[model samples]
Target chain A: MVDYFNEDITSLHDKLVRKEISVRQLVEATYDYIDKTEGKVNAFITLNKEAALKQADALDEKGVDPDNLLSGIPLGIKDNIVTKGLKTTAASHILDNFMPVYNATVMDKLDALDTITVGKTNMDEFAMGGSTETSYFGKTHNPWNLDKVPGGSSGGSAAAVAAGEVIAALGTDTGGSIRQPAAFNGIFGIKPTYGRVSRWGLMAFGSSLDQIGVMSRTIKDSALVLNAISGHDEHDGTSAAADVPDFTAALNQDIKGLKIAVPKEYMDEGVDDDVVSAIKAAIATFEKLGATVEEVTLPYTKYAVPAYYIIASSEASSNLQRYDGIRYGFRAKDVNSLKSVYVRSRSEGFGDEVKRRIMLGSFSLSAGYYDAYFKKAAQVRTLVKRDFDQLFEKYDLVLGPTAPTSAFGLGEKITDPVTMYLNDILTIPANLAGIPAASVPAGFSKDGLPIGVQLMAKALDEATIFKAADAFERHTDFHNQVPAFKGGQN
Target chain B: MISKEQVTHVADLARLEFDEAQLNNFTTQLDKIVDFVDQLNEVDTTGIEPTTHVTSAVNVFRDDVPQKGEGRAALLKNVPEERDGLIRVPAIIDKEED
Candidate 1:
């Protein structure tokens, strides 16, 4: 039986406040779980035992104060988030040993709340790939089925939560990096509307598309984390100045009369039957709860992926150019000239996936072709956003499958970049429109892999997302299931 | 069609070299991708405005006032070679005498 230790964040905090368990004990239990399960999952890239324990001990010394909502809770960070004096690798060979001199804005917010970060988690090289196979370090396996991949580039964060390694972790979403992986791994993950969370200190990959996200086993816990880490930051110029609602406070609110739009375009031919059934079942549950469900069409939804690719790659080409062996990262030692050093360092440091993206980005942004490809893609992006704008006029939230299919075999789609890119089709539309989207554990496929149902909301309306996601979780038992590790009986 | 020569040229422009096998592989892969992306030509976008950012906001810039600096040493510490506190590199473009 899973112990009370496995309780969600809010309940765990309540227990802490009641003095049922000390903060030190919770921190120790988290580390114990990490030590036990990390061998099988390989979720964390760096686990700073000293720093984590110190933070936990300090929180304990401060005692249970009413002001500390997330005090003493041990958390994991995606490697892309910069933490002072820790290696912020983004799971790339180029930055294997590069240390950050400062913390990301989100980290500072979490720090202010006294949340103890255990360490940085793994990711695809520069958060580039979907399967996590493209990580410079070895791939992170699915907690459910070891042979299958954990979805990525937030694979490590999702896997860690699913494997009970960390209660929660932070992830960054550019093109469904958080939600898709959360869906694949059978956990709750959320990508807030662009600018809802600050982007300072996150290694840039499609700067306009990137938003820091959260992953956890329960929707409420995910929302709690979101509330803690999200807010305006002057450090990040793109951050929104909108006031953050108390996500946990409004989670229990009824969705009795809320109108939901399920885009017909997302239910096209390529979508798997099992995924469709799961979403339909979720819709039925919503209808029973008194929420009105209707079909809405995002006619330009089909154009989202291509448009996302052009814009994201074009931006990435420019963002990644800063890592040309002239700054703090891996540099080729034997090269004689600066040109040779730049070329050789990048050539040797970046993995195949990273190189492919850099090449694609450069190609997309190249002279003469930008108008035909990048500019045209931008126009299509506007159309995609317009479709969402129209849909929001009639609906409270949008719901769909996070991916067309379930978690695939590790190497099945890696060789074909386009096929791999297709895994994020449904989730990318939200990013393209700069809206908030989340993937919650809906149910399992016949093969027992997890299936995810996504809830997306209009810009800066995360309260709606939390309410709907919490409502879904309250009616489902999928999040209760845990993965059996190696040598463990299921 | 993308040739090995074009691949070499692009690679040179990007400041990298690929092995023979990698060149062959990338050429084939890039050719297919370029062709697939060409499908975008079907949609006619005569007067539509290009969207540079998804959100309606514009010119998201932080204040120009300096808050903190990690120092020049940390910034230039990883340069492969430096002379007189400046990064040293081979001349890709020739310098003219005054």
Candidate 2:
């Protein structure tokens, strides 16, 4: 079997080009690895082994296209992205058996490149929680330490990539969903600037904040996939019309004189000391690499979480109203009235966190509260964006810890919704500003959990983020560390 | 400051129903969350414009063109109840007793 642990997309592509490994061999090896490790990680919601094998066989008959790096490559897709004829649940019971009749824009793009879809990975129900614990299907344990939670709602994607189940995976980030999990799993995950990628067919969470991105073991693999998925799509009005650059070309680029702003609020009280030290050490490494790093202040940082929650939940409440029982998805049994059908179906179908957000959103947007909550939050969002706007005038990037801490124990903060919401405090500002941000493996804690340093760039400047991430990745060995996978035991 | 009655009202608007235990639990949790978000009041936005979206692009229009949708058979595949290619739902109107 092919050694998935050591072989990345480029290496696998080289082998396939030389006819040393057929697509079937690569696909079979991926399933073998998944079969061995899935029970320990619980990273997938549905495994598309049969369809994937059939696609691999077809690719073998046609021969590998040496020009396509993603050709014959096995990739895990986040469950929220609709794949025609494949179960796309978004880890929510309401969508438990959903099978789309059409593919998401990204899936269509991947299909054009001949990338094999391994499966739909798990996530938080409706992408509402900080950890994958809220998934009705069950939580995805961190690959680094199974007893700990994998940061989510992209936890399964991160674990799948980290465990070498697939070459890479797709993850969506609304407020640090992609980056936080990537940090916990010690992988490279980038949440591109809003509108950089099409959102068509992605199950909506916070529509304005959601952007589909790539997660992989190496920065280059992510860049390659990002290249394929980025650019304009008429199907999604939010998609940017700007040209998609060759992100892979940004790899190994020089960063002399690059200005990086380290926000004081990010490292202040509430952030774990070890995570702070790991990020500070990473800042020093950037300085040594001819980049200029300096302390900066985002005065509105404290308000970001509040504003983000209000706005995100408000949007979610509006977006999720489409799940009424009359059309599709789960419907309640023994309902005599349409109102009862709607209420009972939703009450029975949604999980606790989803209901909480819907309630929060409905309350915020309801009569006598819009100005006090939703509108107020929208105005505060302006201030948060202004902070980034001003910083971008002088600094090319903002640096911080991806998450406040690394992979807390399962159920540690699950019961406390306030504490759970605070986990994304450091990462939410970028989403509020609609800027591109990424998490790259920085260092490890005393307990051996991986820490990641976040890099944020001006809107539509993912190339610079990629350049800095690639530079940091090349100078450090953190990304090279693999999890031991001890099966939920310390 | 959020109360159980308020929580129930919001649930009603959201078309969701909760049991007594869930209502009490949610009410307490929502109160805490509301207190947490009240921090936003600390930031004074005297005349700041609300940012509904970050992108500069607005009113993006596509050509007036007709396209095929996923066929009715495919669209109805996931519907909980259907009859004669139509999604079946509970009655919306009442009939007068004859």
Candidate 3:
């Protein structure tokens, strides 16, 4: 078995800085781990072995600045975030061989730091599903249990971090894509406020809701990675110009007297009892720390899911309109006319879940139903945002379960689209509210699968997310436990 | 309230070809989904301003700088046929299959 102590990035970085380990050694060990687990986990879609080694050799030969936060780190990136000269499929058949000519803003930022991006990870095609099962490449199974799914469309990133394939990874959350999978996989993941990270090259899902997120084994690692990637970029018009605090610097903030609100609505009705208990236990830990806790109601919380589907799908339909098989991606043969090309390419390119979304989105945005569905959902979205605003006035942050349940059996709900959609029932409200939320593993379920407790902060308040998650991680050993697959010989 | 034919029509518009069984399945599934969506009608939205974006960002117009990537001109160029910078399709407006 690989030594988890040495394998962890935090420890690896410490060792590398202390001259106990070399970048070459760290890179080789990472490759060895990936070689052992890739066949079973299939977390990565693209691993540039030669390029990785070449970079590692350069880092070893020239040496890196010891003070650099991620000087000699290896990381995974979700394929949707473009990397110049690398094939970025977003796990869709359409872009199977498409190579990006430009790096995404986040990639450029990280590249400036010289962080080694080891591979491109898997995800649901066009990021349209809750499980990586929708991936055209194939389903990515949970590392904890091969029979179960890794939550998605950021599943690959979450699983990669959980399985220790990479120190950390970047994920995009349009509607709980990052946090839900992180919750399911039992790792730390944060979807920064909508404009916290630039979306310059990410294939748009819900443009308004989508934000680049970070995933890692611990909250400190997540914050370190977030600090590197969070900032304003002129390329993304939606990028915030507001000042961003040093997330890593604020990691040790005290939780005492921090007003935490437990949304009673999230605990009642649809939440799984075991998951709720775990969250309640987590909240109790906070209370024991001298933090004030109170019950708050986001009355319109029930409407969050429907409002989310309508708005996310509507944005998806418009965003996905770009994939017509002409510019790039898979183009169908024997298409006599352009119309046939558009229809056939998309119909064949997208998976069933994606098609379902496109159709629903089209209907919602269609002329007749616009006011009835799309418009109404938007109005409710405001009410949902209002709930967060009202609650934030009284509380420093809001806490809830990331999902109603935990990592389900691989094919359990895949056949039933509604059941599959309901997986993000809890996470969707944060997306609708446009808040920054992070999922930290609370505890294990009865079946031994991981359940996540989420903390959401007001827009651009990543400091609060880090503060709460940091304090929580300091209290729990859950972040230190690696999945069974991490046993090197697996 | 959507019929099987309506589903088929929308499928055709989306250019997806489903078999009879899949069609029937999609019809039933979509009917339930549409019914679920119909619940939006229950909330009295009288005088509630419809919000398409939560941030209230409007027109979000980036400067219309000339660029070579998939643009309006490039998209119009891909349509089966175009007349004076517009997509040309069979006139479905007048041929309503009532």
Candidate 4:
């Protein structure tokens, strides 16, 4: 029996190409592996067994195609992304049975490359919260410790990859949704520049900041997935006109004389002492790799959390208004009037965190307060962008801890939304700036929770992010560590 | 701190109907969150422009030619109430002024 669980994308792809393993065999292994771990992990909201098998049989008969980057590898996507004929819930009760009739642009790209969709992973309701605890489907526990949260709203995708449920996965980052969870789970994830990937089929949480990205076990795997899914799409007006590069070529690039700016403010306050040390160790490793690391100030760092919440929630409040009971999704059974249909359906359908965000967002964007709140946050967002832009002219990348701390206990911060919001303090700035950033597993804390170091580069500079990440990963064994949850079972 | 009335008004604007308990909960949470973001007021904007999007992605127009989209049947598939391929909804007016 081939130990499919131990292989990453690159090795797995090689095995498929060499005809050493059959696609049907891999699909079966993936399902069997998912069945074994899913009870403990709770990674997927819906599994695509019937469709995956049909795709797998066709692949086996047709033989592997090297040009098809995904070939036979299975993928897990966050539930918010639309999949044609597949139910996409966004881990919310409102979308509980909403099967998208059209594939999202990214989904079309993945389908073209012949990757089987293993399932849709759970997430925070409407991508509103940090911890997966806000998911209507129940929390996806961190594979490292069953008691800890897999940070969200891309939590289930991160946990899925970490637990070896899927070879690679897709996640959307609004405000650190992708990077923070990847940090918590100790895997690799990227939030490509805002316009780098199309948002055509993604159910928008924050339209301006949301960009779909890859979650995988290695930097190499992430780059390949990025290579496959990224590029301009006419379906999304915000998609970039910039040319896509062969990101895999970025692997093994020399980081000599690379200028990396480590934010001094990120290491202070809410960041834990252990997380600080892990990031510091990453800085030392960069120095050893011949890259210059210096402490620079993003002086307005304190304002990121507040600015992000206002701006993101404001946009979310407007974007989510489409879910009125009239079109699709859940409807209030007893509502006679149109107004009641809108109010009652939304009231009953949305989870608490989603409701809270909608309420705050609507209030901020409401008549008199728009200038005071929404407009003010936008101005602050300008300062945050300027800070990174100015640094990028002199530095190749900005380095920081992906989150303030490692994965916390599941029930710990659920009570305080403020603290949960604070978990994104470090990562929110990247989204605000629309820069490409990646989380590379840096080290483990004393408590055994994974910590990740973030690498951010100027807009459309995913190559440099990959270069630095590849350098850091070549030296660290953190990405190679499998959680005991899987090791014991296997 | 945000008042219950403000919360109620905002809830109405959001089209979300909540009961008394939810009103109190939302008011308390919104108060703390609003106060937290209120820190932005102290930062002087001077001559700065608000950034709605970082990419500065300009309007991308397609030709007037029509394109394929999710068809009528697909669009109506998820609707709770539908009639003859059209979405069924409550009447717009209960009683006319005239």
Candidate 5:
């Protein structure tokens, strides 16, 4: 059996090329490990084992390509990415049985490189919640401490990777979904610049804020996947036409004389002391490596959360209008009128958190309240972007804690929506500004939950983010530590 | 502070319905959220131009060439109800009211 805990994409690819392992064997081993571990983690919404094995057999017959690092590597996809014939529910009852007629652009790219898709990971319904508890499929427990959340809406993807069910997973981040969960799971995740990856087939929550990204045990593994998925697409017009670089080439690059900025607002009283200390130590490590670090004021940071919610929800309220029960997805039974079908289906299909966002979004965009809420929030968004733009003038990257605190207990903040929303304060600015940001395992908290330090660079500067993150990974042992939780059935 | 009436009105606009208890609960929660977001009003955005898209790219266009679309069978596969290769929906105009 292939041991995912010790193996990464590059290592597995080498093994396949050398004929030391067959793709079929690797696919079998992945399913075996997932079957053994999934009872406790509850990370997946659907497992594509039968098709994955078939793909593996075909790959084994075609033979492994030596140059392709991702060839035969198994990955867990976030459930929101459309996969033809595979159930792609964004952990919402609305699309519980959704089978896309075609694959997402990212899936098509991965398929071309011969990557095996193990299954679709669970997420918040429509990627709305900070904790995965809002999912219709139930919450995903953190592998580190079973009672704690894995973080959302990419919680399941993070947990699955941390549990060694898959070496790497694809996750989407609107407001900290990918990075926060990666921090909680003690792994690596990177959300590329807003237009770095295509969103043509991703279930839209916030069109302006959402971006697809990668999560893995190592920074290099994520870079390998990012290299394949980063580029322009005719399908998504927002996708940048900028040149895609070989991201893996940035690994182990020197950090001497690199200027780093720490926003004073990020290190304020809102952050937990443990998380702050971990990030402080990380900053010190960069200084030790000959990089200069300074505390800079990004005063507009305080307004980021409010602006992010307003903008994200407004976009979501518009994007989700497509699910009207006439074409596809869950339809309310016994509804006679078309209006009744639309109302009843949406009300019955969506969870509370989704309804809450929709209400807030609709209210904000209403005729009477537009200027006070939506327009004001959009204007605040300009200031937030300016904060990053100003910082990028003096600093090559902005470093801070990915989340204010480590993963909290599953039900601790679910009942309080505002408290949950505030947890994303640090990560939201990156999305608002449309910059590339990443979370790498910095250290563990006093209670043994993982903590991650976020490194953000200017728009389309994912290479620098990767370079700095890889250097940190090389110097730290935090990424090597695996969770100790065994499934109850085990 | 947001009232239950406002929440209900917004829910209707969003094509969602809520029971009395959920409306009461959501009103309280939404009030807290609105109050929290109200802090954004403190910032001075008077001369600022609102950013609609983060990237400067606009009016992205491609060739007008026709491409093969998903066939009717594939498109209708996910439909809850279908007839004559088209999605079936509840009647839009109420005959009794007319």
Candidate 6:
């Protein structure tokens, strides 16, 4: 029997092609793996077992084909992306029973190439909080340590991949949702430029910042996924029309003469000492690899956290208005008036974080406050982007820590919203600047929690990130360290 | 700092219901957050144009044609209350449905 759960996508694809394993057997083995590890991980909100088995059986009958890019590989999808006939909750009670009638364009892109999606994984409620602890379904634990949070709102997606629950997963990033979780879980996740991937099927958190990207075990594996899903779709007005590249081709590229920058602003006092040392070590590694590393200043780095919250919350307040109890999902009881129905259903259906964001957004967008808060924040966003534009003119990429520290305890910062929001400080600049960024497992903290080193390149320059991250992985074995699962009948 | 009455007005605008305890809880928490984010006021943003989106994509229009996607039956299937394939809601004028 194949150790299906432990294998990466490339080798898994090779084995299927050589008749070393049948697709049905592979799918069954994955199910066994999930049963053994899921209790400890709590990654999925809904497992697609019945349908996956049926599909795998049909795929086995057709015989394995390697020409198909994904070719029967197993994947996990974040809950916010819709799949026809399957429940997509965004890890909130309001959408607890919401079933989609159509698959996301990304799902359709993967489906055409025959990738088997195993389940919809859990995440922070409506993709708001930095920790998965805010999810209505309950928290997703960091696979490395049960007490710590898996960074969110793509926490489950990163956690599942780290624990070998799925080969890879799709996650949406708005202000570092995908990268932070991937860092916290010691995996590789890429948040392509804002318009690089279609957002048509994604649940909107911050419309201008949100983009669907890959969360995977390795940069190469994620590159293959990016190859299948990146392009313009008429459905999403903002999707970029740039030609999709063969991202996998970038894996072996030489970074010998690549000019890179290390942001001085992010290395400020807010960064944890252990994380700073790890990222410094990473920069030294890049320098040793023949890449030139120098200091660059993004003078407005401190402003990203506040600006992102205001901009994202303002958009979220507008986006979440569709969840009134009249159609789809959960509704309130004992409401006599239409106005009461709107208020009661929403207040009861949403979690604390969701409510806070909506209120925050409402306050920002209110008549008297718009010009001072929302408009000022948007102008700050322009300055942030201009920072990137000026630096990218001289350097090929910029590097920093994905977060200030490694994954913290589950309830550590949730009590104070500002403290929780501070976790996104280093990662939000890329979102504000509309650039592509990625997090690769750099090292571990003193407590053994994983730390991630971030790499940001200009828009549509995903190849540079892959090239650099692939180089780092080749020289280190940190990504190979799997969390020892503990709990529930295994 | 935002007062309790102002907090209530924002919640009303957001269409979210809250009891007295919740209002108090939120007021305390939100005041700290707002005060924290008010640091943005210190930056010089004069003559800087607001960036609505970071991309150059604009004015994209798709062909108006029939497409096969999710149908009405599946959509209406999730309604909390329904009648004759229409989603039912409480009366807008404060009248309860029996």
| lDDT for each residue of candidate 4 in A1-490, tens digit (9 for 90 to 100) | 4454578776777888888888888888899989988989999999999999999999989988976657988999999999999999999888898989999999998898888999999999988888889998988988998888899989999999998888789999999999999999989999999889989999999998898999998888899999988999988899999999989888898999999998899899878999999998999999999999999999999999899999999999999999998888999888767888888999999999998899889988988999998988999999999999899999999999999999888889988888889889999999999999999999999989899999999999999999999988998899998886632131
Docking class of 3: incorrect
Instruction: Give the per-residue lDDT digits (tens) of candidate 5, residues A1-490.
Output: 6898898888899899999989999999999999988889999999999999999999999999998888889999999999989999899998988889999999999999999999999999999987789999987989998889999989999999999999999999999999999999999999999999999899999999899999999999999999999899999999999999999999989999999999898999989999999999999999998899999999988899999999998999998899888788999999889889999999999888898888888888999999999999999999889888988988999999999999898789998998999999999999999999999999999989999999999999999999999999889999999997733332
Q: After superposing candidate 4, which stretches have Cα over 4 Å from the reference? A: A2-5, A486-490, B96-98
lDDT of 6 by residue, A113-142 (tens): 889989999899998989988888888888
As for TM-score, the candidate ahead, 4 or 5, is 5
State residue A64's C-alpha deviation in candidate 1, in Å: 3.2
Cα lDDT tens digits, model 1, A1-117, are 224236877677777787788877887778887787787888989987887877777777878676666877778899999998777899988888888877898988898888888
RMSD in angstroms, candidate 3? 4.5
| Model 2, span B8-93: residue lDDT tens | 88998999999999999999999999999999888889899999898888899988899888888889899889999888887778
Please tell me which predicted candidate would have the highest DockQ against the true structure: 5
Write model 3 residue lDDT over A357-444, tens digit each, in one string.
7777878888788888898998888778877898888899899999998888777887777677777777888888778999998999
Better of 1 and 3 by DockQ: 1
Query: Of the native A-B interface contacts, what share survives in model 4?
Result: 0.86
Compared with the true structure, all predictions reach lDDT values of 0.84, 0.93, 0.82, 0.90, 0.92, 0.90
TM-score of chain A, cand. 5 = 0.99
- The superposed Cα distance between candidate 1 and the true structure at residue A280, in angstroms, equals 0.9
**For residue A371, what is the lDDT in candidate 1?**
86
Chain B TM, every candidate: 0.66, 0.92, 0.58, 0.86, 0.91, 0.86
| Each candidate: RMSD | 2.8, 1.5, 4.5, 2.0, 1.4, 2.0
Candidate 3 lDDT over B1-98, as tens digits, reads 77888777777656676778877877787777777766666666677765555553444556769776645664453344458877554334443332
Candidate 1 TM-score on chain B? 0.66
Query: Which pairs clash (backbone N, Cα, C closer than 3 Å) in model 2?
Result: none
Query: Which is the better candidate, 1 or 4, if ranked by DockQ?
Result: 4
**Which stretches in model 5 have alpha-carbon errors above 4 Å?**
A486-490, B95-98
